[model samples]
Target: MSQTNPMPNSNETPTPMAMMQMISSRWVSQPLYVAAELGMNEAFMGKLVDLEMPVIAGGRERTETEYRPLLGAAGFELTNIVPTQTPLSVIESVPV
Candidate 1:
């Protein structure tokens, strides 16, 4: 009798069904934490990045609320936003 594997064959390109099964499975995905210079004017450093990022990198700084939907759309849940003494804030998220 041929055994049918429940896991996807990594050699082959993953189909939408395989991807969905992986997500719905009991596999625990790793969390993502990003320490970014967010748009908080606590030390004036955040304002600097907020102003310069758009001109220099064509990316604007974002608030925690602004990042919620953005991250959520990518299958991650915005768990926590921890602010440091500096302008940087740790944005924590877990995969859904």
Candidate 2:
């Protein structure tokens, strides 16, 4: 008779919430990747490079929403239901 190694197993399953988090992480990563590819972070950083404001956010003017889809492709999103020339505080990265 040959000796066999004994293995221990336990019942541990993934919860629905855990699975959801995993799925969401993948979805958000795509957007982040696109944002990085489009140089979104560099663009934003350039604007703030020289500004005299508590917080630097500029050059957000006259952007055509027509290219929003392109931005989506690059994992970037800028949405504002209100019609104003104001720029919202947004950075290029994974959206929360």
Clash count list over all predictions = 0, 1
Name the top lDDT candidate: 1
**What stretches of model 2 exceed 4 Å from their correct place?**
1-62, 75-77, 81-96
TM-score of 2: 0.20
Compared with the true structure, what per-residue lDDT tens digits does model 2 show for residues 1-96? 332222123355545444334434553234332112233475675565445243222322334454365445544454543332223333342323
Please write out the lDDT profile of model 1 over residues 46-82, one tens digit for every residue: 5677786765334866887888887776576788888
Query: lDDT of model 2 at residue 56?
Result: 24
* RMSD value for candidate 2: 16.2
Against the hidden reference, what TM-scores do the models get? 0.45, 0.20
lDDT value for candidate 1? 0.62
Best candidate, TM-score:
1
Error of 1 at 21 (Å): 15
Model 1 Cα RMSD, Å? 9.3
